[model samples]
Target: MSGGVVTRGRERRDQQNGQNSKTIEQKRDEEQVQHAEANSLALTMRSGLEAISKEIRDLKTEMKKDLTTLKEQVTEDVKSEINDLKREMYQQLSANTKTLQAQGSRIAEAEGRIAETETWNMEVKDALCKSLKQQQMLQDKLTDIEGRSRRNNIRIFGIPEDKEGDSAPKYLHQLLTTELSLPPNVNLQIQRAHRALAQKPNINSPPRSMIVHFLEFTVKEMVLKKAWQKKIVVEGRPLIFDHDYATEVVQKRKAYNGIKKLLKEKGIRFQTPLTKMRIPGTTDRSSTDPHKKQHAMPWQRVGERREGTARSAKEKLQEFERITQDSE
Candidate 1:
């Protein structure tokens, strides 16, 4: 019985031991599952860290590139400012130099003008002194000439009669005393004759075909010469010169022509004649008889007996023939 009991205990002990072994194996499998879970969590955390590190490196690279670009921009801006400052400085310096140079030139010119003015004043003073002495001599010479000859009117020519502007009036008067107070046989007109010839409406003047006019004082040739030398008009058109007789003839001719033109315009009946005439009060030809009141001079040879005494056309022809025969 004791042996059987002992064997049963041994069996029970073995069975318990096998059950503990199975529990041990189950605990090991639980530990393995836990370890695998821990490993999976570590791998996931490592992958996240790697991704964050790459992002940080990329951000750092972009920041470095932007910083370099910003540095380059700042450098260019500073260089441009420096260049602008240099240009402004140079411009100011050049302007200052030019201003100084202009001031120097003005100063030099002012000094030169002052010197020239002083010289001119001295020359004017010398001329005035010399002119005063000459006036005394001229007075004496003039008195001697007056004593030698009787007071006579000398016909002078070649002086300006009409002009808008010529020599100063005072200067021209001075010329009359100095150049034209002449002796006999010497016409001061010779001095001005050449200029008149140059401007002779026949040919022309040189350098330019400027019509020059010489003043002709009525009768004093010496005074006229002085005036011509002192005063002359230079222009492109010709100057019209008229003598005393010529001007009178021209005035009469113009008056006659004007009367004729007025008569023609008013439609007056008048015979044309060699000399211009007027129509009675208007522009009539002059034909009148002194003996009769209502009578007019015979214009044509109307009566045969009247032809001998009266100034008819046939009588005028006979008179002209008699004069011609006498001349021959």
Candidate 2:
């Protein structure tokens, strides 16, 4: 029995040992499978990471290209806008300059016209002044001629007009001898005698004046003086004698109307010495004979009362100087 029991024990021990060794061998096999699976997983992970990095690099390259394109387009648009603005400004400046030039030309033209008008006005003024001076000179000459024509003639007013027919001259000669108290022995030469040329008036109207021409100038003045001294009367009317004067000279002598009226009111005897009328108290004629035309107006002597009325030379100079000032 002991031997049998020992043999079983030995068998059992051997069986145990065999079982443990098989278990260890199986574990080793499992470890080897796990290691192989881990290696395969690590390789797959590495391949995925590489794929992701390549995708990121491709995205970065695409973004850079888009940005560069956008930048270039923006620069081109800005350059185009600047060129359009520059062209518009240039056109506006050119238009303004043209307008200013036109205005300047118009102003210059207006100024030239104004200057020409002023010059023309001055010329017209000078021409008018010259014409006025010529007219004055012509009037003076005409006055002188008219006065000369009447130098040897006398006008007799208050002479009746009658139908003496062809004997008008003879009738006047006989009347001068009788009415004027002329010496019958003295041959008073008469050139011609005639009534004024006019239509016959009513019977009650004043008689026409008679024009008497004398052969000599001295005789004409002598007759006028005698007629004035004698105060001849005809048909109950007093005859008046006067020197034949031009109408202009008579009008000029009318300046003494106030003086004549004053003298008449004062009962002072006044006479017209020549073309100029005078008041006797102020000045006297230098002629010995008051009726002599030769000694007329040439010399005038102011009386003692008028000596103080004479103006000084300095006063005359002052007046001359003031003439231009006053005219201005």
Candidate 3:
């Protein structure tokens, strides 16, 4: 029984040792499993961090590229706008300069025209003065010729019209002798006799005036002086004699009506036949003849100057050429 008891206790002791060894082995296997799980978790965390970091880097790169592209585009647009503005300014300045040049040229042309007009006016004035002086000289010559032509003519007025049976000169001589009651032997030489070259209505009408031409101017003066002294009447008609004058001389004589009236009122005897006022007895006479009513006679000078006639187109061109040569 003792041997068996000892052996049973030994067997119990061996079984306890085996069970402890199995438990130890199982604990060791559990520890190894936990360690493997921890290692796997750490590997997973590291891989996730790496993936996040790569994503961040990719985003930063994309943003940088986008910013660079934007900057380039903006710079190009600004450059284009600046170039356009510069070109527009240059074109506007050029146009303004051209316009100013055109206006300046027009102003210069107008000034030249004004200067030419003033010069032309002065030249025209000078030409007119020369023409007037030449005309005055011509008029003086005509007046001198007129005075010499009327030196010998005599006019007989209020003579009876006659259809003469004989020569007109002989009949007039006989009439003058008979009317003057001259001596029967008086020899009255007559040159020519005729009525005025005017129309006569009838033979019985108041007779037309007669004009007689004497052989000598002295004889005519003698006859005129005799007629002035004697009141010669034929029947109931009275005859008169005067100096034969031209129509212009007669008109000039009409202007002396005031002087004649004054002379008559003062009982002064004056001769009308002479061109100058001639007093038979007195020598003092005025040179300012009443018959001369013109402001500027042929003998008188014009005191005031007048603007001359405008030059003809041809003359103006010639003058312009002369002025241009002088200036050059």
TM-score of every candidate:
0.29, 0.51, 0.45
Top-down lDDT ranking? 2, 3, 1
RMSD of each: 31.1, 17.9, 15.2
The residue ranges of model 2 lying beyond 4 angstroms of the native Cα positions read: 1-117, 163-165, 283-328
Encode model 3's per-residue lDDT on 1-328: one tens digit a residue: 9999999999999999999999899999988888888888888888888888888888888888988998998999999989898899889989988998998898899889889776665555555545666666665556556644544556777666664335777877787677666678865556667777889758667777776777777767777777778887765778887877666566777877889999999999887654557778786554445564556544433565434433553388688799999999
Highest lDDT model number:
2
**Can you list the residue pairs that collide in candidate 2?**
none
For model 2, how does the per-residue alpha-carbon lDDT over 1-328 read when each residue is reduced to its tens digit? 9999999999998898888888888888888888877888888888888888888888888888888898999999988989888888889888988988998998899889889766544444444444455787798789889878888888888877784367777877888888888888856677888887777778999988888888888888788888878978778888889887888777766776777899899998877765665556776543333475632122232232222223333344468689979998
Highest TM-score: which candidate? 2
Poorest stretch of ten by lDDT in candidate 2: 301-310
lDDT of 3: 0.72
Stretches of candidate 1 off by over 4 Å are 4-12, 99-328
Instruction: Rank by TM-score, highest first.
Output: 2, 3, 1
lDDT scores in order: 0.52, 0.74, 0.72
Which should have the higher TM-score, number 1 or number 3?
3
What's the C-alpha lDDT at position 244 in model 3?
Answer: 72
